[model samples]
Target: MGHADLVARLVEAGGLPGEWRSVFERVPRDAFVPDLVWDDDRRPVHRAREPGRWSGLVHRDAPVVTQLDDGAPDGVGYVSSSASMPSIVALMLDELDVAEGMRVLEIGTGTGWNAALLAARLGDGNVTTVEVDPVLAGLARARLARAGFRPAVVAADGMAGWPGHAPYDRVIATAAVRRVPYAWVAQTRPGGRIVTPFGTAFHNGTLLRLDVRDDGTASGRFGGDVGFMWTRSERTPHGSVEERVLPGHDHTESTTDLHPYEPVSDFDAGFAIGLRVPGMLATVVHDGAPADGRFTVYLMDPGSDSWASWRITPRPRGRYRVRQHGPRALFDELAAAYDWWRRIGRPAHDRFGLTVTPDGRQHLWTDTPDRVLDLVPDPGKERAG
Candidate 1:
């Protein structure tokens, strides 16, 4: 589709305001993207700024990876930055509810494409964005400047949030976070909105919108499914495999109770299990073997020096048997969370909400009984904004 058609489709999709169609039409996506990067399938390709080809990439509904492995040329490791997918960006913007002249603070500047969109909607002076990497931040600043849009581009830890531009009308994070930062709530004005992708280390991402209160607390609903790179500080991989992979005595016995079962994919289920079981690292394993193939979930808790496994055996009838092993009984925790979902009759994503306290505690809430669980942070550790 052409740029005009893409913009029109996005508007018709209803995630972005009608006024944004013009902004999308005006901004050239190729200007902010890198010379070459991986596509969605991890294929190495160059999205060269050659008019027709480049415009095609921009107009596509998918997000193009602008920087892989934190801007590494080899594209090894994980995805660190990108020009966010059009639909996800539109969903986040809708949750942000940014108004004309509203002051906005964006964490994770990435290619500065989202910043440009925000600047176009809220005006340049109303937007302030922070990027942790000096090189990425510099490039984004230059690109935005070249695009004739200037927002306060700061080279600093986004987790701290740019205090100089405090009391923002909206604070949006492009990165995924396991816990909502207190600084974001502290920086947002009363009744202002703070939107970020919130999930456990194990699951994909969910966009959360919380309204900040004067008491430094915030609450709001989970907007939709999202996926983003982990915050820079929480991006480190955990170590010590033996303790997490081996079976232990405390492992819970498997039960026939399927009350907690929620129909989530292996990836999402592993993530949700990891979050529910604090201090435990969860991983999904697929052997690619034939004949009723199986998937296994491994949970490691270094603190307890224990590991556990949940083996899911699929039957011909589309049912699964969850077997548990190891001292920690990680599958039990997962099953418990699944049961929680079942007890609530499998509530929709919008029915779930997140609350953040000034002390950096994240709580997940559901409408049924309104149960809240604290997403406590690691002790003696402080993360950058």
Candidate 2:
């Protein structure tokens, strides 16, 4: 499809607002994207080899993989960077509510497409984007310049943010984070908005819109659903939990009525479970026989040897077999989380909010500040947000 058709579709879908329509049309995505970009299937779609296919993918409302494994050798090791889907970009920008002449700080400069759009909407002088990868940063800077835009592009860790241009009116992060970095809150002006993808170790996240307060606290509700690539410094090593095991671990046998897939099968439930139980990596392993009912859910703690596995049969109504190792009761914790979710009427992501203090203390709340949910309770702090 053509750019007009793509922009039309995006506007129809409520991704691109009327105000951003002209800006989106001006900055062509093709200009910033690399020639050898990866498709959704992780297969390389070269512009030289197939110009038609490359253009189609570029104009479509989809994310284009820009860098793999931080530009490491090997065929698509992992998606280190990407041009976010246009719709998601629009959604994040809408949540940001950036205004004319407002200074914006962008955490990730992936293909510089987002920065270009922001620069178009808020002027090049008002936009500053930081990228940790020097190569990506340099390339993005060149691309923006080629596109007739010159947003300040800094090559440094985005987590630290561009502190030199402190007190921004808005801060937006294209990268996903486990916690809303304190630096972002500190850098943004009071009452300013910070938009980011807040994910847990479970690898799922919701777009969060936080507003900075005068007392060094930033709080906001969750917005749209998203799962962006982790920031460079927070990126975890690739490998299954089973690959790394400790010697001194205890094992216990148990059975529960809850199926292993119950919590994770649904996005809202999984997000709730993740918030309730932090620092957990959950993966489902199919035993090559979903028809025969051989499936297992593995839960492991990244910080410790605590791991739990639940094997479920194909039958819908039955007690599933469970095995847990290490000091933490992984299965039991999940059950509790599920129960809490149920008790709370299975609240949606919008009902949830996160508050981060200057000291990096995060508190998850439901609706009001007083009704805080203690995901990881700190000894000195109270549950009150």
Candidate 3:
């Protein structure tokens, strides 16, 4: 499968607007993709060595990691940058809802494919993209030029935004952010739109589309399942389950009838819990390599050096083992968050919305702006270490 095949698949899936179909078809995703790509295992796959595999991945409807740990030589660590999945790219573009002659500002120009799509839809002169990493920005600029489209590829911090070309008609971020930068809102004109992937440490994230109001504030709701890598400045603290939840650590033992199935795995529950219990990360480790159903769900907060382990066995019969360490009882906090969610009619993610003021404060609400989610952290439950 190649570019045409990918476009056909996207069209078949149905959000490829008539206009965008031509844009997607015209701009070659392969040209924007680098010769060096990383596999799911974080191992580098050079186009020269694995041409077929590289082509397949490039054309596949999945995200392709383009850089790891900011291109550090300390060996492949985490996915620092990637060519976002084509479907998500199309979805975000569709949500962007750009029109001809509309000035657009794009954040996080990873592979330049998204920016190319934007430039193709709106003229090159109307599109401006920002990338924090100078190297990635330069490469993306060259790729965009090679593909016959040259939008202003500014090598600057995307979070700050390319303010020189302010008052954009639309602003979209390819990176996820915990806080929607006021610069983006301030740079966008009244009635403009800002679409971004917004998430907290507890969750990978969902799509956020904010409408910039005349009052210099933007407010919008969560609607899509688009999870992008966090901007460098707002990245969640990183720590492995094994690294944080060690056996030697002091802990308080307890039991909970609450299973990990709903709280940790369910989309709605996890999203709600993320909003309630901020800065928490969960990881699951199975008991046996033979593929046993029994596993342990570990919740960690690297910021506070706190962790909680919830073990589940086949036929649990509602009794699960839970052990928590550090001053903050992560298990208790998560359980409380889950209880709160259940208490309030069990809302879906779409019901959640956020408002960003000019001062850069974010307010999360349920259903409407007035029905705010009480997100203030409890001092006992969320103390800094």
Candidate 4:
């Protein structure tokens, strides 16, 4: 598709406002992307080697990985940063609801593509973006300058936010976080908005938009099914399903008629389960080709070194094997959480809401703050914002 065609598709599908049409057209995504980038499948696509493939990936609405394992040469290959998917980026900007000359602060300036878009619309002088990785920050700054956009790109931890430019009209985070930093709410004006991807160890995440109140608290509902990487400071343990979950290890064996269909694959169930069971992560391993439809779902909590596996066979006789080991019964926790979700009428993710207290405590609620979920705050991270 042509640039215009892709922009049109993004605007239409992402529910982007008509005012952003020119901004999307003006900011070219390729300018901020690195020469050596990776696709979602982990295939390395060097722009110099395969210009056509690189251009195709850059032009489309898909996310292009710009860095891996925090740029470590021999790292375990964890995804650290990337340009966000265009459609989701548009949706976030729509939620930001910026106006002419509105000052905005952006957390996690990965490729600077999003910053450039905001700069194009609001002007460089009115935008300031903070990046946790100094290398990424410097690269993004250079890219922004070369592209005729010079938004302030600060090389500092975004969780603390850039308070030097206080009272921003809006704030947006490119990375996902377990908690919305109180610094964001404190830095934003009373009537301003803060948008970020909020998630738990059990799920990749959902987009949360909070309105900062004059009383120094922010409250809002969750929206969209987004899976941005967690901010560096708050990332869950990296992909360690094999290391933690050993099927041969000594474990209590049981049988369950409950399948992985609703609790594992269903987004609504997974999100609610995340709220109930903290510090839990889920991964699916296939017996053979996924087409065979034989697989095992592993639930793990790195904090407690506990793990559970639910096996699925192509032809089931109404029963499946389940094995769990370690101090905490992860399978039981997950099953109980799923049951609670069903008992409460299986609410969609959008029905959930979040409120950040003045002292930086995050509280999850259903429908209204009056109905708060009894979630224990990790003392170590109570002021992490």
Please provide, for model 4 over 1-385, each residue's C-alpha lDDT reduced to its tens digit, 9 standing for 90 to 100.
4567778877777556788888888887888899999887888899999998888888888888889999997787788999999888988999999999899999999999999999999999999999999999999999999999999999999999899988899999999888787899999999999999988888878999999999999999998899999888887666478788776678999999988989998999999988888777889999889998799999877777788989998676548899999888989999999999999889999999989989888888889888888874222122222
Query: Where does the lowest 10-residue lDDT sum fall in candidate 3?
Result: 376-385
TM-score of 4: 0.94
Model 2 stretches with alpha carbons more than 4 Å out: 241-250, 289-293, 377-385
- Each model's C-alpha lDDT? 0.71, 0.84, 0.86, 0.87
Q: Please provide, for model 3 over 1-385, each residue's C-alpha lDDT reduced to its tens digit, 9 standing for 90 to 100.
A: 7899999998998968887899899997899889999888777899999999899889989999999889887853878889999999989988888888899999999999999999888899999999999999999999998888999999898888888998799999999877788999999999999999987777768999999999988998998777889888777656677677787899988888988888888888888888888778888888787267789988888778988899888774778899989978999999999999999988998998988888777888999988876674211222323
Q: Residue 221 in model 3: shift from native, Å?
A: 0.7
| Per-candidate TM-score against the hidden true structure | 0.82, 0.92, 0.95, 0.94
Task: Provide the global lDDT of candidate 1 against the true structure.
Answer: 0.71
The C-alpha RMSD of each candidate to the native structure, in angstroms, is: 4.4, 3.7, 2.4, 2.4
Local error of candidate 4 at residue 221 (angstroms): 0.2
The whole-model C-alpha lDDT of candidate 4 against the native structure comes to 0.87
Worst 10 residues of 1 by lDDT: 376-385
Off by over 4 Å in 1: 48-56, 73-75, 236-275, 279-284, 287-293, 300-306, 313-327, 368-385
Candidate 2 colliding pairs: 293-314
Q: Which one wins on lDDT?
A: 4
Candidate 4 positional error at 42, Å: 1.3
